[model samples]
Target: MSEVYAARRTRLREYCNAGGSAAALVSRPANVRYLAGAAPHGAVLLLGKTEDILVCGPSADRPSQERPDEALRVQTLPGAAGGDPAVAAADLAQGQGADSLAVEEHHLTVARHRALGSVAPRLRLAGLGGAVEQLRVVKDEEEISCMRIGAEIADQALGELLESILVGRTERHLALELERRLVDHGADGPAFPTSVATGPNAGRPGHRPTDRRVEEGDFLSVCLGATYRGYRCEIGRTFVIGTAPADWQIELYDLVFAAQRAGRESLVPGAACRDVDRAARQVLDSAGYTEGLTALTGHGVGLEIDEDPQLSPAAMGKLDACVPVTVEPGVHLPGRGGVRIDDTLVVRPEADGGPELLTITTKELLAL
Candidate 1:
């Protein structure tokens, strides 16, 4: 793992050198963690001409699991100025005689950017422009293994929820229970907020859990993920509450299942990201259920719940092998509930047995 982090930093250093910057400041927490093994609170990474350093604020606590790679030097700042490690990192880079430093413009606020410039008046500031994010698009086998474990944890959590009584349970109650289960099943934590939508709220992406209780024949949609070893994987499944699903419920579920399958099947290496989205979207579109569709069919997932190589109609780029992404597609009628089926899968070559599925929970519209 230390060698992996060192190699990642080496790649970033080469990128910075090619861009004419001798130093690079990584302020984004995720990017910092990608380069340094862990991202302490208020910590930043400085790839200086002399040496790479993980700069920590006074308040930052280096947990055993969150420690930076031993290959990188750690510098702790003192007092009020420690609140912003990027400024201290910039100052250190200037002292290291770096002529120019590249920083993540997207992650820095105007005030923070100004403070960095103020701290290193002589150093030329350049935009890193998602360079670190680009490097993170593809997953190494170790990273994929982490996500796979996370997916299994999520699957166990969801499977347990399905076995227990669900009727009369409020959406908020179910969501909270699922999160607790994720932790109980050995997850670092819930990857994101567990979403439990009941009745009319079902199938809505990013729906906040409400007080609505599960009722007979209501479409119960749930979206959840678990974070294991800093890697995240998502899984969503829709079920029918109480009684047998109505004809409309089965239709909607089948439609969404087909669409999700299409999206998953399109995840081969070298396939266009937009095309993957289209494959899923066209199914819903052809069914005359085009209106109110989500802006994206699916998106990449990893250290962050959402990452790169977004599977969207407007997304650019080709799918790369080992890139894990979700294929979630759904439909919801105005006052009536709908269905959603989502799964996390890793893109792979044809000879590699196609995309590798991480989440194994059944997508069948089970009645609870």
Candidate 2:
């Protein structure tokens, strides 16, 4: 793991060198964790010419579970409280004789950026852009294993919820229970908020759980994920409450299921991101259900639930093998509700059995 973190930093250093910067400062928590193996609160990674350093705030202690790589130097800024680690890292870079520094312009604020320059006036600052994010798009086997474990935890949590009594429970209560189950099953936490929507609220993407109680003949939708070892994975499923699904419910579920399947099938190496979105979206669009559809059919997931390679009509990029992404598509009718089917999958070559499905919860529309 130390070697892995060291190798990642070396790659970032090479990118900075190619861009003519002597060092790089990573302030984004996710990016910091990617390079340093852990991101303390208000911490930054300084990939200096002399040595890579994990700069921390005065009160930023390393998490018990996520320790910094032994190969990297850890430094706490000299202060009692409240100082930007990014500024301190820049000062350190200048002290190390780094002529120029590359910073994540997208993640830094204007005020913070100015403070970095103020602290290191002689050191040139360049935009690192999304270099680290680009580097993280494809997962190594270890990273994938973390996500796979996270997916399993999520599946277990959701599976347990399904086995319990769901009727008469409020959406919020069910959501809370699901989160608790995730932690009980060895998850660091829920990757994102557990969404449990009942009745008309069902199938709305990112719908926050409400106090509405589940009842017979209602559409119950749930979307959840688990974070294991900093990696995240998501899964969503819709079920009919206490009765066989009606004709309309069956039709909508099947349509959404087909759309999700198409998106999943299109996740191959070299496939365009937009094409994958179209593969799913077109199914809904052809059914005249495009009005309330979400902008994206799916997106990549990793250290963050929502990462790069967005599966949207306007997204520009090509899928690569080992990139894990979600294929979630749905249509929410204003008052009638809708259906959503989502799964986390890893893109792989056909010779490797195509896209690897990580979230293995049943996609079959069940009457719960």
Residues 1-368 of candidate 2 have per-residue lDDT tens digits of 99999988889899989999999999999999999999998999999989889999988875578999998899988776678899999999999999999999999999999999999999999999999999999999999999999999999999999999988999999999999999999999999999999999999999999899999989999999999999999999999998699999999999999999999988999999999999999999999887978988999999999999899999998999999999999988878888989999999999999999999998899998
Q: What is the lDDT of residue 148 in candidate 1?
A: 97
Candidate 1 has its poorest 10 consecutive residues by lDDT at 59-68
Candidate 2 lDDT trough over 10 residues, lowest sum: 56-65
| Candidate 2, lDDT over the whole model | 0.94
TM-score of 2: 0.98
Clashes of each: 0, 0
Tell me the RMSD of model 1 versus the true structure: 1.0
Would you list the clashing residue pairs of candidate 1? none
